[model samples]
Target: MPKADSKFISCKPSKHGSTLEGLAPSTVLKHSLLILFCKDPSTEEPSVSGAETGIFDASRSFHSQRSLIEQQTKDSLQVEKELHLAKSQLLSKKIEDLRREECRCLLLKRRGTELACQILASKSEIDALEARHQAAECEYRQREIEELEEKEKTRDEFYNLRMSELEEFKESIRRFLLDNRDKVQKLQDSVSENTCDLLAMQLVLCNVMPMQLKSTLNLLQGSDGYMDNGRIAAAETKKSELLAEKEKLEKYLISSDHLRTLLQKKLHKMLISQDKKKTKALTKDQVEK
Candidate 1:
């Protein structure tokens, strides 16, 4: 029994073996004894002594128990090694999956950053375009204002010149009336006199032939008899001068009217051209948007 227990102690549990390492030595002995009982002896035991047979059985059982314990230890060690290997493989796979997930997340973050940069760049471009459009519009309006101011200045100058001409004309007309007043008074005085007195008055006021004067005086007497030939001639001459001056004024008025019409037409054409340009620019801008 002591030898059997010593042999069983030699069967040390494997470091990486199963929980069965705690099985009692008594259980191993029982198993071995059961194996012996179940087997048939090679020789008939009738001639054998009881003590020798018991000794033989005990020796055989010890050998069997030793072999069984060794085989069980080997199997438990193998199973434990396999379990550890399987656990290692599972942990490695999980780590690999985590690494792949981390890489995917990093790539996605980089792509998002690139997209944000592109969006900001596009927004800046749009802002610049808008600024340019506003500047162009402001410049166009400024040019239009300057053109209108220039036209107004030209119109003011034209009006000022026309007014000055009218002032000169009025002055000339007043001077002309003053110079002719004495002559007109003399002619009126002479018209009331007889032929001899008229002849004397004509010679003093104006150089005239007696025959012509007598014919003019008789023609005057036939009518209201207040007007003479000198006064009539002076009136006709004054009417001619006034008619000529009126014709000149009419021609100037007509020319000014034609100039104003031409200027208006030009202004309308320029406005239409500006509108067409603006429409084309707006159309292009819309297409870009």
Candidate 2:
């Protein structure tokens, strides 16, 4: 029996590859020999008690180690979950920032495009306006030049007409003076011939014939009539000279009228030129504004 106890006490818990066989709880309680071993009546059977104590100790150590491992695993899992949530949040924020930047860039690009279009439209409008202004200026200058030429032409025409009229009036006065001079010379010659005939008749006979005397007296009467006519002709000549002087004055007046017309035309041209200058200045001012 002592040999059997020693053999049972030497048995160790399962730490090796194969398990050692043991009795069931019901079997051990029912057996009388097993009960004697738990009592440990003899001090020499202490190894036998050590066997049971070792088994209890090994089970408690295993349970404690398992609990520690389970708690450590739970903590690690919680930390990992927290880290993953943080990463997800950071990525979401980054995506939102990228979307906002893209939206801002698109808006800026659209604004730039609109500004370019507006600049182009304004440039085109300015070009068209400048072209219209240039055309108007050209047309205005052409009209001004034509008006000046027409005015000069009219001045020359009026001057020429006045000159022709003056020449015609001078010629008429000269003809009238020549005709009056010819008539006066003819009357003077007839009076001188009658005086010579009367002197010859007195020398030839103391008494002249009655009929001849009557004819001589009639000649004297005719000479008197001619002298009256000469006086009237001299008065008419003075009248003609006065009329010629009046006509000359009238011709000078017509020339004055033509000169006045020319002066008016020049003044009108000057006014037009001033207007053109003002228009050009106004156009420049508007462009600057």
Candidate 3:
């Protein structure tokens, strides 16, 4: 019923325009004729009058039916046009909704691409930083290794020098012992003879002492057998002292060699530990990057 009423309103103006051409005059003429017919009766026979009244009633009923049909036709046309307009508006709204949805989908795709690009860039930077950190760690480890090697080399050289000096001192002691052996043997022979004057004459005969000694030598020349008495023993004592010092230095060198070996082992272990530590640190830094 509401739909039908809305249709009537929409058709009111057009119907009014069309009806203005003839409907208004026709309605006035029809009403005027009805009034005239009601006022005046026929002047024919009574039977004719009754027939005339019936005819007038039939004509009035036909005009009312025609006017009702016209109103119904206008109402139907208005209802159809209103329905069409509503359908067009619904279709437009649906199209607009679809367009908005399409725009939203496009925006979502663009944002996804942007996020992917950002992730890729971040990953690239992280990789680069990790590589640089590993390189720096490697450089630092190499330097530590070089420094350890240098220190060990210097220590070895020092030990070698000390050993060489000890060997040289040992050789000097051996030579001194050899020279003293001869002097001690000769002195023992002379003292076994028990001839002070015989030794003096033997010294002159053997030309062991110079016939004309310098004044400084004459003052200390204890009858030409000075070296045959205590000189050999004194020289042996001095040589033994020097040999002791050389022996002590040799012992120290041996101890130092042992220490060097221990140091080498320790250094090797430390280097391995350092390598492990550096590797772990590099891995951590890479992950952080």
Candidate 4:
């Protein structure tokens, strides 16, 4: 039923009772009229008083039936109102639960978005750090290579310098050896000349000494007669000249002895130097081979 149709129509109990009483009288009058119209045509005419009493009984039964029908309709309307209220409450509860679920979903989605952003930021930082590490590694390798190259270059230059110094030293030693040899040859020539001069002086002395001895013997044999003065004076002059020549030869011999000693010392030093040079040359040749 519609809401308005189900609404109660109010009436005072005393007034309703009086209206039903008045309605009973009017219903009896209508029933009397129906009985008058239904009388048998073939039978004797019915009495007015009897028909009026039957109409009154029928009107009382009709009022009782109408009251029962009205009471049943009121009970049915009360049950329907109770059922509608229960359904409205159930629908309201469902709507509230749906609202709560939607709020929960929104919160979860927002949190998830924040987490995703954080993850991306962390990944980017890792990538940047890796790039820096690689660049540092490359720079370190470059420095090591440069250092090795520089060391190699310096080593080459030092080796070349050492070789040049060795060559110059070898040249100086050769020059010194040649000069020493020349000096020794000149000294040998001087010693030989001095020896030849001493031998010639000795030959002259041997001849002059025999002549002086013969003159002395003749002087001793002719002592009884007066000696010739001219002969004696000539022998004396010749003896003085021979004695002076012998004295000069003795001085030259002493000087030659000192020269010979000096020459021997020089030869010893030259021999030692030559032996050292030969050994050095052999060692150098071995190294070259």
Candidate 5:
């Protein structure tokens, strides 16, 4: 028994053998004893001894125990392998999920950065547009102011020129009125003298004509009366000539008065126009202010 145990313990399967190669030392010893019992009894010595029979029975018991242990070991190894495989697959899935999350985060960060840059660019463009609008508005206002100033200057120059011309016209009218006044005064004096002379001549004619007529009638009593008639006709002719001269002087006085009235009206119109122009200039100045 010691020799058999030694031989079985010394036997070992190769590293690249079957499942029995990985068995524990005690299991390997059981398998080796079972193999020895399976050999034909004829191949052994034909002597029956009580000690040998006892050894055979003990070997049989060891064989049954070895088979049960081997079956249990196989089932345990199968269960452990399945558990390891499941753990490895779960770990691989977790790694893949983590990689995907990291990629998603990187993509989100890049998109956020791009959006920020775009927003900044848009803001700069808006600022540039506002600046341009302000500049254009200022330029337009300046141009409008310059145009108004130019128009005002032109109007002032025109007003000054017109005023100068009006002054000169006023001076000429004054001189004409002064000269006509002296002429009118002389004509009035002449007319008065003529009227007084005519009145004196008419009085003398009235007194002498009747006296002469009466004397002619007395002196030439039975004569033809032709000489008396002729003398009367001559007196009448002299009276008609004096009346014609008086009518001519009256006509002259009427024409002079009409001319003076017309001159006064023209001077009044000129003064009114000047006042209106001054008022217009004042209104424009207020508006500009």
Candidate 6:
């Protein structure tokens, strides 16, 4: 087998030399076959068998290497496809996240716009309410002023009427006092005249009769003595009537004084009440101002 392999290598030295210089596999295979044919017919069998065996081994090695390269290419393509799919999925996820963020931002902007509009509306409503309140206050103040003026006018009218009535009462009281004084003076003059008349009668009686026998003579008197007794009784009755009239006049004067004091007290109270009302009104006006 070794001698046959040596002979086969010697037979194809030039062809093998060309094959080693990077020739195509078909060219190398053609060169090998030509060398095999050109061998002596007596040595052909063993050389042909050795060349065929080497050709078969070379063909098997080429087929195995081709299959290994195809499998490596398929595995690389699969890996590239997987990486591309992963990248696509990652890009899609990023796009989805961005879309969600945009939606959230838009929602926030819309909410902010709605809130701004609500604030403006609230401000306008507050301004309108304030205007209405101011107007109501003005109307209330006007009504209060009118009412106060009416009350003051009524009070003045009432005070004037009361003053007129009080003046009339004072005038009537003065006239009553003046009339009582005249009556009292007249009564005094009458009492004095009656006293003088009584004294004259007493003197005449003393001259006409002894003091011890005066009572006895008056008791046993005839017609002239009886007349003198009647005159004395009439004078005493007149004096008693005058004293009763004087007492009645004194009572009337005292009642009139009490009535005047009560009127004065009532007037003073009314004045105090009016002053209080005035002070209250002034204070109220100041507060309103």
Which candidate leads in TM-score?
5
Which candidate would rank higher by TM-score, 2 or 3?
A: 2
Question: Clashing pairs in model 3?
Answer: none
Q: lDDT by residue for model 5 over 1-289, one digit each (tens)?
A: 3344453543333355433455687775575464455543234343434533454566667656767888888888888888888888888888888889889888999998999999999999999999999999999999999998898898778867766876776677578657766765765676567556656655765776578667766665757544566655765675566567656655655665576577568657756876786687678668858
**lDDT to native, each model:** 0.62, 0.59, 0.58, 0.62, 0.66, 0.64
Model 1 lDDT tens row, 52-146 = 35644675776578679888988888888888888888888888989988998999999999999999999999999999999999999999999
User: Which of the two, 4 or 5, has more TM-score?
Assistant: 5
Sorting all predicted structures by lDDT, with the top scorer first, yields 5, 6, 1, 4, 2, 3
Give the candidate order by descending TM-score. Answer: 5, 6, 2, 4, 1, 3
Q: State which candidate, 2 or 5, has the greater TM-score.
A: 5
Residue 141, model 5, lDDT: 93
Candidate 5, lDDT over the whole model: 0.66
Lowest-scoring 10 consecutive residues by lDDT in candidate 1?
Answer: 4-13
- Residue-wise C-alpha lDDT for candidate 2, range 47-69, written one tens digit per residue: 33454455445545655676788
lDDT of 4 at 24: 64
Clashes of each: 0, 0, 0, 0, 0, 0
TM-score of each: 0.36, 0.39, 0.34, 0.36, 0.57, 0.47
lDDT of 4 by residue, 1-289 (tens): 2221121122112433421234466554543443334432223223334444455455445545655777777777777777777777777777777777878888888888888888888889889899999999999999989988898788667656756775676576567657756765665666567557656766766875676567665775668656767776876787787668667766766765677677677767766876786677568657746
What is the overall TM-score of model 5 with all chains considered together? 0.57
lDDT tens digits, residues 1-289, model 3?
Answer: 1122232222112433432234455553443354334423333234333434564466567656766898888887788778888888888888888888888888898998999999999999999999999999999899989998998788667656755765575566457556655655554454444345444554553463243334324544756635433654554575566557556645555555565566557656655765675576567557746
Which residue pairs of candidate 5 clash?
none
Model 2 is weakest, by summed lDDT over 10 consecutive residues, at 37-46
| lDDT of each residue in 1-289, candidate 6, tens digit only | 1123443455433533422246566655765554544443334234344545575456556657767998888888889889989998999998999999999989999999999999999999999999999999999999999999999889778767766876675676567557755765565565555555545655654564354346545654855555465655765576466557556655555565565566557657756765675676567557746
The runs of at least 3 residues in candidate 6 whose Cα sits more than 4 Å from the true structure, single-residue gaps closed, are 1-77, 191-289
Global Cα lDDT for candidate 4 = 0.62
